[model samples]
Target: MNLALLHDSDFIDHDRVRLTGRRFAHLAGILKVELGDQIPVGQVNGDIGVGRLERLDNDSAELRVTLDTPPPAPLALSLVLAMPRPKMFRRVLQTVSALGVKDIWVINAYKVEKSFWQTPWLADEALSENLSLGLEQARDTLMPQVHLRKRFKPFVEDELPALLQARPGIVAHPGTSTPCPSHINRPATLCIGPEGGFTAYEVDKLVAAGCQAVHLGSRILRVETAVPVLIGRLYDSCAN
Candidate 1:
């Protein structure tokens, strides 16, 4: 973890926070930090700064914090994704969060297995934990929002249009004529289907809802592999 991300619950007072569980283990066992040593820290969705270790032991550690730095700039993008396989889903969540995608839609697609939704990784706590890990990896504090839409029709028809109003949308299809646009400065809502790609009918619905169908050249990428490449293609380098 590049930054020790503290939640509101971690604070004992305005300036002090107590770290425990995974965070404590990381500092005590891996980092081997000493009192008066300063470590990078940030309050979730708040500020980035440093925490000077005021007290420490095996059980827990306390630090006095001063937050002044701003969090990294968020991506000017939203993601509409098909739920991935259970094992890959966790990594995808972390990847997107680290890339600064603040808005996400986990939707159903024709090729997506029903069992994919049954994964424990989609549980509230698990989602939060993985997202936290991603934020820490990026040294960012702003939490990304994940929305689950099990029924594809209603979401693509009823809800997606509104989101597309602010951010013009696109869906990644393997054989589409249009190449996925590069370094798009405007905020966008991007859609990616399951491993086999979205069926013709599904693509039509998204198109009707304002998403342009596009492709990433000749390669057919797995959901996990495609995400970062698409994100990088769509946005400029993130500012530190």
Candidate 2:
């Protein structure tokens, strides 16, 4: 973890926090921190700053913290993605968060297996843990929101149009004629499909819902790879 993410529960007082569990293990074991040392810390959805270690033991540690700097600006992008395989979903979630995608929609596609949604990683606790790992990696504190829509048609017909009203929508398909736009650096919602890509009927629905179909050249990238590439391509926020 690059920055120790602080939760409200971690605080004992306005300026003090107690660390335990994975965080304590990392600091006490991996970082091998000494008393009086300072470490980077950020409060969730709050500011970034440093914590000075005042006490330490095998089970826990205490830090006096000061938060002044705000976290990095979030990307002006909304990601609409087909649910990925269980094995890959965790990594994809972290990557999306690290890139500063604050809005995410995980919808079902024709190729997406129903079993994918049954994964424990979708549990609330697991989602928070993975997102926290991503935030810590990026030294960011803002948590990304994940919206799950199991039925594709209803989501496209009902909710997508409203989301598109504020941000233009783009669907990434493998053979589409239009290349994915680069450096738009504006608010947009991007849809990506499962491993085999969205079926013709599914693509039509998304297109009808006001999404422009675009491609990332001839190469087909896995959802995990495409997410970061697409975000980097579309947002100077990520690059900067």
lDDT of 2 by residue, 77-183 (tens): 88999999987999999999999999999999989998998999999999999999999999999999999999999999999998898777999999989999999
Local distance difference test scores for all models: 0.93, 0.94
How far is 124's C-alpha from truth in model 2 (Å)? 0.4
Q: Residue-wise lDDT of candidate 1 within 6-108, one digit each (tens)?
A: 9999999999999999999999999999999999999999999999999997789999999999999888888999999988899999999999999999999
Task: Provide the lDDT at 49 for model 1.
Answer: 99
In Å, residue 119's CA in model 1 sits off its true spot by 1.1
Clashing pairs in 1: none
lDDT of 2: 0.94
Candidates in order, TM-scores: namely 0.97, 0.98
Best by lDDT: 2
Q: What is the lDDT of candidate 1?
A: 0.93
